[model samples]
Target: MEPLGQDEIRASFVNCTRGEAKGVTLPAPPSEIPWDRREFLGWRDPKAPARAYLVLPYGGEVIGLALRAAAPPKSRLRSNICGFCTTTHGLADITLFSARRAGKAGREGNTLGTYACGNLACSQYVRGELKPDVPQPYESLTVEERAGRLEEKLHKFVARVLESR
Candidate 1:
């Protein structure tokens, strides 16, 4: 995926209002990101750990989404797998993140949730920069294939969010 500018990132959000897009914090510049190894850029807000964000280059334009982390369970384990990168992680490292539906459904409080890396490091995990304690199902696949699969899942999730209304 190509690097994105702050303006482009802000304009790419389909699941949030314009004011919300302007107010959210963006990840570092493209030069700071390891683009060659990343399928998408994701990060948690420093000021608000509960708030997360994901941005990817989809179709001919960039697509961004705002995510909210769900409350943790009483017990922590290391067996959960991220839906995007398919990497297994400890309970604290995995989060159930939810995205509000786009447009009217979102304004009405509808959201979709999936288990993901708590730190939003799916790109790194898929690239093998961050190793999972448990073996991933895609271990047999080439790194490029794994990354492609991750991107496809992300696109589907985004589509679901936008079409849920």
Candidate 2:
């Protein structure tokens, strides 16, 4: 199947929240992530209505991301290696922030917990080895630019979910 778009993801969020969805699980391709029980690391919560989980698979790289609102404790503090750069920097350099949703994900009025590198150390999508202490290879972009890029990518995926419905 083609990569899920923002719309499809949004619709899934609605169905899940309303209890209309029996089960919605997005599995990582076997080639990227191992086919283990834990491989299904998607979101699941009865209380929250507009949230969804994304299991980004860039090869063996697996980063757990919670797409929900940024109200209070929703902005969590977790430590993990960067999916692109496999550096211990994830502990200090990474900060999970609230992401704005699009389409239905946005319409559902949910927030996204985006785990992003604090600095421009690694490309958000490209696979790389994060060096916490070392300087980044690419020229640094403004926070606005970084956020915009992230939003674009996220919306694309969310849109897929909306269209599926």
Candidate 3:
């Protein structure tokens, strides 16, 4: 992923109002980000644990989505998998995050949700920089292959949010 400044991030949001986009926080400047190691920039709102955001390179431009976490699960299942990184995690480490659809659909309260790493650090997880709480099953695929799979899933999720219908 390329480096993205605050202005780009604010402008890239399609599922949020302009005012909400402006309020999204970046813990550090764009230059300070470890861009080479990331496939997308994702983080929760520092002030609002329930709010999160994701920005990634898509087609010719960057796309961003504002996400909200679903209510906490009642049962603590021992294992779960993140849709993006395909890593196994304890139920508590996974979250069901929903993003409002773009355009009129979003305004009408339409949304799509998927389970993912609660911290939104799939990029690091796939690269072995981060590890889930439970042991991950061995995969024959190489790191690059896993990363490609992550990128593909990310793109699909973004496309669903951007879909007009």
Candidate 4:
């Protein structure tokens, strides 16, 4: 991923009004982000933990989404896997996040959700750079391959958000 500026990030949102996009609270300016270590930029709003955002270069353009994190599930499974990076973690570490669909569908209240890292750190989790809460299952794929899959999954998810409208 390439580095982004504040204006670019704010203007990339496809799922919300320009005013809403302008009101988004970025975790930090793009200059502080480790661009090489991220597949996309994501973070939860400190003032509103349930509110989150993801921005990425997709389909040859930068796009962004406004997401809301669903409450953690009370399932029997001891661990959960992130749909984007396939990284395993304690149930609390995996969260279901929903994004309002772009355009008229969003205006109509349509939304889509996917299980993802609660901290939105799938990029680091997939690379073994972030600590795991549970013993992760071994995989034969190299780090690059895993990273590639993460990108593919992320792109597909973003596509769903865009196409839902």
- For all predictions, the C-alpha RMSD in Å is 1.9, 14.5, 1.1, 1.0
User: Over the stretch 1-165, how does candidate 3's per-residue lDDT look in tens digits?
Assistant: 988888998999999999998888875689888999999999888889999999999988999999998776988587789989899999988999999999999999999999999999999999999977798888999889999999999999999999973
Tens digits of per-residue lDDT for model 1 on 1-165? 776778888898888889999998766766787777778889998888899999888777788899999888667465788899888887777899999998899999999999998898888887778876656663588888988899899988988987964
Q: What TM-score does candidate 1 reach?
A: 0.91
Which of the two, 1 or 2, has more TM-score? Answer: 1
Q: Tell me how far candidate 3 lies from the true structure as C-alpha RMSD in angstroms.
A: 1.1
In model 4, where do residues sit more than 4 Å from their true spots?
none
lDDT of 2: 0.41
Model 1, residue pairs in steric clash: none
lDDT of 2 by residue, 1-165 (tens): 123333343343432443333344443333553223121234433455344455433223332344543332333544554432233452555545443453466456654445444442334322233245545456466644653554455445444444433
Worst 10 residues of 4 by lDDT: 156-165
| Model 2 alpha-carbon miss at residue 19, Å | 35
Roughly what TM-score does model 4 have, to 2 decimal places? 0.96
Q: Which ten contiguous residues of candidate 3 have the minimum total lDDT?
A: 70-79
